[model samples]
Target: MAADKVPGMARIAVIGAGMGAMATAARLAVAGHRVVVYERAATYGGAVRRFERDGFAFDTGPGLLPLPAVYRDLFVKTGKQPLEECVELVQVDPSSRHLFADGTQMSLPNASRAGVVAALDEALGAGAGERWGDFLVRAREAWDRTRRPLLEEPLWPNWSVLADREPYPSVPHKKLLRTRRATTLAEVAAWELRDPRLTALLENHALAYGLDPRTAPAGAAVLPYMEHAFGTWYVRGGIGELARAMYERCLARRVEFRFDASVARIAEKNGRAAGVELDDGTVEDADFVVAGVAPGVLDGLVPGTALRGADEVPPQRGASSRLTVLLALRGGRPEEAAHRTVVHTPDREDELSRLFGERPGLPAAPTVTVSRPDDPALVPDAEHEAATLTVTVPSGLPVSESAVERVLGVAERALPGLRDRLLWHEVRTPADIAEATGVDGGAVPAPALAAADGRLLHPSNSTRVPGLFAVGGWAHPGGGLPHSGMSGALVAGLIVEGPEFRGSQ
Candidate 1:
C-alpha cells in the first residue's frame, strides 16, 4: 500500500460503489490522495449483488469472470496483497458446456485453444472444428488491433478513426460474382464458419452480453477470444466475493465510503468541478470528481454542463436486459457437472427476431445459461444445491409469468429433471435490475467495439468539463466486469498522471 505522494495530495470524490469506482478509489488512495466514495445504496457492488434465502446464495449479476487480469492489475497497483490473497480464484476446467439445437453437446476445455477446436470438431464434425479454429485466428487479430485503444488506454482524440476502421480481418467471400468482406458478426459466422450450429455458437458470445449478432461489429469476435485466451474463473464464495474484496481493498487504502449517501449534483466552481452536492443540499468540495454511474445518471447530475462534445460517441442506451431464475435444488450438485452450461435456442432467427426485431418483446425460445456451481458456500449442506438460469430479454419489457415458464422449459435442456429437483425458485426481471443499478429499463451495456460507425464506442473518460471524469461500465470501453475494472484504471491514470497518460508501463 506504499506509494509516494505527488507534489500536493488533493482531495478527490467518487460517485457510486460499483467495481470500477472502488477500483479507482483504492488506487487513488494508494497514490497518497485523500479519496472519499459516496454510494447511494446501503452496500457496495452495484449490480454485482447476491441474493440469499434459506441458506442458498446466488450472484445476481455476472456468474463467471473473464480476463481476470484486469482486477489482478488493480490489486497489484493498489496494495501488497495480491487479488488471490483476498479471494480464492479457481479456473473452471471446462470453460462452458453447450447444448445446441440438435441436442449435440460440446464441452470446451478452459484456456486451451487446441482443446477447444478439438471439442468443437468432435461434436460438430471435423470441418466444424477447423472452421472455428480459423475464426479464432481472425478473432485474435481483431483483439490485437483494438486491445490498447479500446481497453488499457484512455479513449483517444482521434477515436473517430477507430470507429471508421474495422479491426477484424475477415476473409473476402465471393457471393454472386462480387467479393465482400464480413462487416457484421453474423456475416462472419455465415461466410466463414459456414455451419448453422457453428454460427449459433460463435454468435452466442455476443448474445450472452445482450448484443445482437445481426448488427454487432465483426470486431466483436474479441469477446470469445478473451474467454478462450484468459479462461473462465470463479470467486470461491461467489462472483460477489470479488466485489467484497475490492471494497475492502478500498477501505484498507484509507478510502472513505459513505453508504446510503445520495448525490444531487456535481458542484461547479468557475467552470471547474468543485465537488459533489448531496441530496440534502450539503456540499463537500474536492479537487476532482469521478462519476461511475450510467451516462444518463451522470448527465442528470450536471444539468447545465455539456459532458461531451456533439461529435463524441454518444452514450449507448437500452441494449438489453436479463431474466434470471434462481433455483434452490433439493439434491446435491453433481461433481462432474460443468459450472456453466448454455442451452442454445431451437430457432436462432426466430429468437433474435422476436427479441430485437421491430416490436421488441420476449422471445418464444430464448437461449438459457444454466449455472450450477459445485461450491459448498452456496448451499446449506451437501444435500442441497444452488442453480441459476439466465436469458437475455428486451429491456423495459414486462416479463410475463408464461415467459418465465418458457425460460424454465429451455433450461431443462441443460438441467435434466430440473422441475423435479427444484425446491423453490425466484425470478428476477429487468425491473428488479433497474431498482438495483438505477439504469433505466435495467438494460446492460455491451463492451465497446471498433467500427460500425462509432456506434459501439463510449465517450472519453475525460469530459469537456474541467476536473470532471467518467468511469465504470457506461464510459470508454463500455460494460462487463472486466471492461469496467479497466475503465477505473484508465480514469485514475488520466487524473493522477494527467490526460497525457498512455496507460500502465
Candidate 2:
C-alpha cells in the first residue's frame, strides 16, 4: 500500500513494475516524490524473469547483461550502495565462441578489441581479423555520433534528422558505373567484411537482436561495436539477479509496488494524465503517470487518446521474438568451457528466408546460441550443470516439439553430445514472452537505432499528453536490459528537470 502523500511532494503512479518503471520510481522517490508501481504480474521484473525447478535456475529472457554502466549510473544516482554491492558481475572471457557450419571456429575475448581482432585473424584467416577490426572502427564512429541522442537524451524534437542520417560510415561499393555507400547492414557485411565467416560474424550481432541484416540500417553497426567495447557479463545466479537487485533498490527508496494489480485505464483529466484505474475499478490519483507497457496495451488504457503526434516515431511492431530451451545436464560444467557458444546455421539463406519470408516458418536448421554459465548457484550441486539455448523466430506463434528439436540439434554442434546428456529440457515460446510483454506476438523490441528511416527508433519518453510519459522498451532508447534501464534515467531526467533537461551527466 502507498503511504499518504506529504504536503510538499507530488504523487507519481508508475504502471508496471518492470525494470524501467522500477528504476524510474526509485529515482523519482529519491527526488522527494511519492511513487507507487502497479504491476499485473505477481513479480517485479518483466521479461527479465527467472525459472527455477529442482534446485536449478535459469533466466527465461536475456541470459547475459551488456553495458553494465547503465545500471552503475542508476545505482550511483539512487543511493549510497552501488550495484556491485547488490549483485556480482562475472565478465565472460572469450566472450563468445562461434562454430560456423563450414567447420571453422573462433573465440572472441571479452571487451578487448585487439584481442578479438587477433583471435579472429588467427582462427578465421590472416586478414579476416583486419576486416572485423576495421568494421569495429567504423562501428565506433556510429556509436560516437549516436550515443547522446539515441541513448542519453530524450528523443529530439527534430528526430527526423536522426531518422534520415545513417551514422555508420558504411564503405562504398560499385554497382555499375557509380559508386554508392552501403545503405543496409547486409551491404556493409558483404562489401567490407568480404569473407562468409566475417559476414556471419558481423550479421550475427544484428540477427541476435531479431534484426534482419539484409534490411537493418548500416547504423546498426553500433550493435557489434557495443559488444566489442563494453564486454558481455553474467550475474552470479542469473541475469534475473540484476532485476532482483534493482527491485530491492526501489524498495530501499520506499517506492511502493502493488503486484497482481492490473491497470485497466490511465485516468485522464483536463487533457492530462491524472493517475490509473485498476481492474477492480479502484482509482488511484497521482500528479503524473508513467506507463511501462506494450504499445497495444498502452493504447487501450486511454481509448481514442492521441498519445503520440503524427511526426513522432510510432511504437515498433512485428519485431522478432525468441524460443528458448532450458537444458539440465547430468555432469559438471567444464572448467575451461566458454560461457557462450553460437552455432551458426549451415544455410544462412534458408534460415533468413524462413524467418522473414512471405510465409514465415521455422528454419530447418536455425542458428542457436548456447549458454552454459559456470555459476554454482544455478545448479543443485557441482555435479550438475544448466544450459540454455535460444533461437530468434517470428513472434506470436505456437512452438512445436520439432522446433525444440531443431534448436537442440543446432546446439549439439557446440556441446558435441548434447542429447546424450539425457537430462530434461523446458521450452519457452513466443506465447510465453507475450504474457510478459503484452504484445500480440510476444515480439521483443530492439534498441532505438540512428537510421533506417527512423523505423528503428521508438516513441519519446514525453508523450503528447501532458503529465503522461512512456517508459521501458516501448519508449525512447528502446529495449534490452541496459537500454530499458537507461530509459528510466531519461524519464526521471525529463520529469525532474522539465523540458530543458538534456540528459544525465
Candidate 3:
C-alpha cells in the first residue's frame, strides 16, 4: 500500500507513555491521527525516571545516550523545533574512563578512532592499542553488515537469514595449532584483544546491556563501535530531560496522555486490535492499538494470540536488571573527573558465573558504572555533587546490604573518600524498576543482535493480531535509548506507509 492511499486519521491508542510510545504518538499525530497514550504511572517516561531531593537530581535510567541521531530524526520529523532546541545535547568528552581491575586506567575520547587507539596504547601498552583498533575496524564491518537488519529495518519474515549469518568478520586465530573463528563476544575478546584489560573492556560493553559476553553473538561488537563512532551524549540536566522533551513534543502535536491509566487487556474486533480495556473497565476504542510493554505483559494482555511466533518463545527465565544507588555528596565534583567511570570487577569469571549461573549471588567485586556529571543542575550548589552508581545484577534477585556495600566499595575507587563525602544515598533495586516500568522482574531488554539463533531478537513490530503493534525497548530493535527511539520510528512507518514500507531509508 502506498503512503498516500493509506486510510486517513484513524484514532491511535498507545498503551504506554515511554519514550518509544511517545515517539510513535508524536509521529502518528503529525501524520494526522488522533493519538491517546495511557500510562499506568502518574507520569510519562517509563523507566526513564528522575529522582530529585534537596535540589539534587538523579537520572535512574540511562546515564548517557548513544546514537542520538535517532531522536534527532524524530524531533525533525514530528515538530518545528529540533531536538537540541528542546534539550541541550553535549557530547561527553572522554566518552568513558575505564578503571581496570589490575590498576590500568584508560580514557577513551569521543568519536575519534585514532584518539581511542592512542589512549589505549598509552595506557595498556604499545601493541595493545593496535590490536583493539584493528578489532574495531572489523567491528565496523559487522556494524555495516547488520546495522540495517538488526536496527533500522523491521525484522524480516525469514529472520533466519539474520539468525544464521554471523556478520562479524572474525579474524582466524591458531588455538593450540588449530585455526578457529570467534563466535561469541568473549571469544572475540580473548582471541583478538588477548590482554586481560582489553578483554575486560570489550566484555564490559556486553555486560552493561545485561548480555553475557560468553553467549552474546560476535555481532555484539557493534555495541562499543557504536559508542566510539557516534560518541556518547548527555542532556544538560540528565538523560531524563530527553524524555521530558519528547513528552512535550507529543503534547505539542496534540497527542493526549492519560496518566494513572492501566490497560487490563487489548480489545479486539474481528481479529484485529480495536482498542484497550483499562483497569477501571472503561473501553476506549481506536482503529489501531500500540503496546509499548514487556513481552510478558503483552502476552497477558492478548492471551491466546501467539505474539511470539511458534519458534520464538524464549524459555521461561528472568532477564537481567540494573541496580542504581543515587548518592548525595557533601563535596563538590572535581574539575578533572570524568563524566562516566566504569570500575571493572576484580574477578570477571566469578562475577559472570554468579550472575548468570543457576545459583545467583552478588559478585565480591561487581563492575560498577559511576556517573558524576559536572552540571550544577544536579547539585544543591557548587559545594555539593550528585552521583549515581549502577551495576547489572540478575533480575528478581533481592538487593542485599552486602550488594550495596560491594557497589559502594567499587565506586570508592573512582570517588575517593566516597563514604565521608556521602550525605545520603538511595538504592533503587529491581523491585523499584518493576514497580515503575511494570515489566516482570524489572528485566531491562537488551538491544537486538544479528546472530545466536534469534535468541537475542525481539518480536516483530507487527504481531499476528492485525492492527496491533509493539513499540519500545521490548519491541523490535530492542532496548537502549537509541533502540527504543528506532522502534518508535519503525512502528510509525509500518502504520503510516503500510507493510510495503520496508524501513526508513
Candidate 4:
C-alpha cells in the first residue's frame, strides 16, 4: 500500500513514549513531518525510568548503557549534542561481578581482556583466560560482520530475501544458527576449558539475557564482547537521562506529545491503517504510524489488525518473565560494587524457581546492583551515600506486600542487615509494569527471535499492515537500548524511502 500523503506538514502519530517512540518522532520531525507522541504513563521512557524516595534515587531498568554512538547519531539528527549536553557517562571498569554457587567470584572489566584473563587465571586456572579470548575473537568476528547488515535491517518478510541482496554471506547468522540453545553454557565451556570454575564463569555470561546458561543460546555465551569492546557505563545521573535526552530532541524537532493518552485502538480502513483511537474515544489522523509498543499490547489495541495473513500470526513470547526489586539503601551495600553482583546458588535454576515459587517474583537475595559516588541528579545531593539493589525475580509473579517482605528477607541473608538499612523499597510486579508502561504480559518487547527451524533467529519489525511499522526491543535485532533505538531508524527509512526508491537512487 502506498503511504498516505499529508500536505504542508505531514502528521505522523507515534505510539508509545519510550526511547524507540522518541527516536522515531525525532527522525520523522527532522524529515519534515509534524509528529505527535502518545504515552499512557504519567512520565515517559518505558523501562528506562527513575524513581526517588527519602533522598535516594534508583533507575528502574537498563542500568548498563553501551554503544554511545547510537545515542550520538539520534542527537545529531535533531541538531543536539547528546554526549556533551544531556549526560556524562564514565567508562566503568569491572563490568560485572559473578558470585558462584561455591562462593567463588570473578569480576569483568570493560575492554580489559588481559585483566579479565588474569583474574580468571587466578580464580580458575592457567590459560582459561586465553581460551575465553579465542571464543571472543569468533564472537567479535560475527558481531562485526553482521551488526550493520542483518542487525539493523527489518526482517519481517523473510531473511532469505535480505540475504540475497547482500554482497556476501552473513557470519553472525552462520554462527548463531550453529549455536545450541538447549546445551548449557557449562557444557560448552567444559568442552573448551579444563577448570570447573572457569566453566562456571563462562556460563555466567548467559545471565545477561536472564536465561540459565544451560538453556541460553551458545551465541549468547559471547555477550562479554559487548562489554570489552564498547564498555559498560551509567548515565551521569541515571539511565533516565538517555530517555530525557531523546525526549528533548523530539520536542526540539516539534514532535507533539500527548501524555495520559491510552491508545485503545489502531483505526484501520479497508485493511489499511488510518490512525489511532484513544481510550477516551478521541480519534487522531495520521498518514503513517510507528508502534513502539510490545507486540502483545498492539494485539489488544488493534485486535485482529495485526494478523498478517490467514495463516500468519504474531510469534509467541518466551515464558521466562522478570521480577525487579528497587531499594533505596541508607548505608552502602558492601557485598557488591558499582555495576552488578550476580549471586548463584547451588542448582541456580532451581533456586531461581524457588525464589519465584509458582508465581513470578524475586528470589532470595537474588542479584544486587550498587552505584558508587552516586549521581546526585538521580537523587537529591544528600548528606549520606545511597545504593540501589535490583533483584530479578519471576515474571508475572503475584507480588504483594507480604511477598515484598519475603524477598527482602532473602536479601538480608546475602548482605547482613540489609533490610534494616533500607530507607524504602519498591517492588515492581509484572502487572505493575504492565499498568505503568503498556507492555503486554509486562514483557517489554524483546520477544525471543525464534530460529527458522533451528537455523536463524528471525524477528519482524515490519507489520504486514502497510504504512504501519514496528520498532523497539521486541522487534528486529532484538532487545537492548541500542538495538531498540536502531529499530526506529529502520522503520523511518522504510516510510521515507521504500526499497524501490533506494534501488532507483
> What lDDT score belongs to each candidate, Candidate 1 first?
0.90, 0.89, 0.90, 0.63
Estimate the TM-score for candidate 3. Answer: 0.98
Better of 2 and 4 by TM-score: 2
- Angstrom error of the Cα, residue 405, model 1: value is 0.9
Candidate 2 per-residue lDDT, tens place, 1-505, comes to: 2121223478999999888998899999999999999999999898889999888999999999899999999999899999899999999998999999899988999999889889988998799888888899999999999999999999999999999999999887888999989989989988999999988888899989999999999999999889889999989999888899989888889999999999999998888788999999999999889999988899999899988878888889789999999999888898988899999988999888878777787888899999999999999999888999999999876799988887887888888787888489989999999987687798999999987888899999988888888999879999988899999998887787778889966
RMSD of each: 2.4, 2.5, 1.7, 4.9
Compared with the true structure, what per-residue lDDT tens digits does model 1 show for residues 281-321? 99999888999898889999999888888878889976899
Shift in Å, residue 365, candidate 2: 0.5
TM-score of 2: 0.98
Indicate the residue-level lDDT of 358 in model 3.
Answer: 90
Q: Return the clash pairs for model 4, or none.
A: 94-109, 111-228, 184-214, 360-397, 446-473, 446-474
Report clash pairs, candidate 1: none
* Candidate 2 whole-model C-alpha lDDT, 0 to 1: 0.89
Better of 2 and 4 by lDDT: 2
Q: For candidate 4, lDDT tens digit of each residue in 114-195? A: 8888877787667878877776776576466556544556563555443323221112322445843223344556565556
